[model samples]
Target: MERIKIHFAYDGTDFAGYQVQLEKRTVQLVIEQALAKIHRQDIKVFTSGRTDSGVHAIDQVIHFNTPLTLDCSAWRNALQTLLPIDIQIKHVEKVDESFHARKSAKEKIYRYQIINQREYDLFKRMYEWHVIKPINIDQVKIAAKRIEGTHDFTAFSASKSNVKGDKTRTIHAIDVLEEFGRIVIEVRGDGFLTHMVRIIVGTLVEIGIGRRDQSCIDRAFATLDRQVVGLTAPSHGLYLWKVVY
Candidate 1:
C-alpha cells in the first residue's frame, strides 16, 4: 500500500462539518465514498483538521492509504471526477507511510471576514459577518497583538469541547487587515481548540466597537473563563486558510 496526500478546497456552506456523521452529508463521508468506489474497498481518510460547518477552506490537507498504484495526476483526476462540484481536489502526491495529516501539521491559519458597513453587500452575505457599527481598527489591532503568544485558551474555546487535555496553545500571530471595506482577521496558531478562532475574533470585534475593553484578552487569559470572553462569532465567517506541515 502507498500513502497519498491530497490538498483540496471546499465550500462548506451546503454540507455539514468535515467529519462524518450518521444521516448527514459531510466532506469526509463524500470523499470516503468516492475513494471506496475507486479502490473497491473501504478507504479511510484523515484530514489536517476538522472545519466547522459553514466554514470554508482554501487549502485543506488529507492523507489516505491505497493499494492501487495510480500516479498523483491520475488520482487527482479520478477524485475530482467522483467528488461533488463544491469540493475540489487541488493537488495530490505520494508521501511517506509515516506521514499523518493531523499529527504532522505544524501550524494552521484561519481567517475571519467582517463587513463593517451599514449597507451589506449582497454578494458577501454568506461569507462575511456584517456589523453595522463602525469598528475602531486601531483598537482591534491592539487587541490582536495582545492575543499573540502562548496562553491557555480555555476562555476562547467552546465550553463543551470533547477534547480532553491541556488547552494551552501558542498563537504565532494575529493580523488585522482591511481591504475594500472588508475587515479581515487572520490567526496563525500551533493548535486550536473548538471555536477558539471565532471566539477570539468576536472578542476583538467587541473591543473594536467599544463593548469590551482592550485588556479583555489579557483578562481572558488570566481568568480562563469562557464567560469573560466576548461573543462567539458566527461560524460562516470563519475559513480554514492554510495548513503548514
Candidate 2:
C-alpha cells in the first residue's frame, strides 16, 4: 500500500460539510465517491479538518492509502475529472506510509470576509457576508489584538458543538485587513473548536458596530459564556485558508 497526499480546494455553498454524511451531500462523500469510481475500489480519504456547511477552502489537505500503483498526477487528474465543478484537486504527492494529514498539521489558518457596504452585489452575495451598518475599524483591531496568544476559547464556539477534551487552544495571531471594501478577519491557530473562528469574528463585528465594547471580549473569555459572545458569522464567508505542517 502507498500513502498519497492531496491538496485541494472547494466552494462549500452547496454541500452539507466536509464530513461524510449518511444521506446528505457532503465534501467528503463526494470525494470518496469520485475516488471509488476512478480506482474501481472503495477508497476512503482522510482530511486535515472538517469544515462546516457553506464554508470554503483554498488549501485544504487530505491523504489516503491506496493499493494502486499509479503516478501522482494520475490520481489528481482522475479525481478532478470525476468530481464536481466546485471542487478541484490542486496537487498530489506520494508520502511515506506513516503520514496522517490531520495529526501532522501544525497550524491552520482561516479567513472570514465581511462586505462593509450599503448594497450587495449579486455575484458576491454567495461568497461574502455583507454588514451594512457603520463600523469602527479601530474597535475591530483592538478586539483582534486580544485574540492573539494562548487562551481557553470556550466562549467562542457554538452551543451545539460537541468538542471533546480540553477547551483550551492557542491562537498564533489574528489580523484584520480591509481590501476593496471588504473587512477580512484572518485567524491562525493550532486547532479550533466548532464555529470558533466565526464566533470570534461575530464578537469582533459587534465591537465594530458598537453593540459590544472591547472590555466585553475579556468578560466573555473569562466567563466562558457563549450567550455573551457575538453571533456565529455565516459559514459562506469563512474559508479554510491553509494547513501548515
**Candidate topping TM-score:** 1
RMSD of 2: 1.0
Runs of candidate 2 with Cα error greater than 4 angstroms are: none
Write candidate 2's Cα lDDT for 121-222 as tens digits.
Answer: 779887889899987999899899987888888889888789977889999999999888789999999999999999999999999999988887788779
lDDT of each: 0.93, 0.91
Predicted candidate 1 versus true structure: per-residue lDDT over 185-221, tens digit per residue: 9999999999999999999999999999987788889
Best prediction by lDDT: 1
- Residue 198 accuracy (lDDT) in model 2: 93
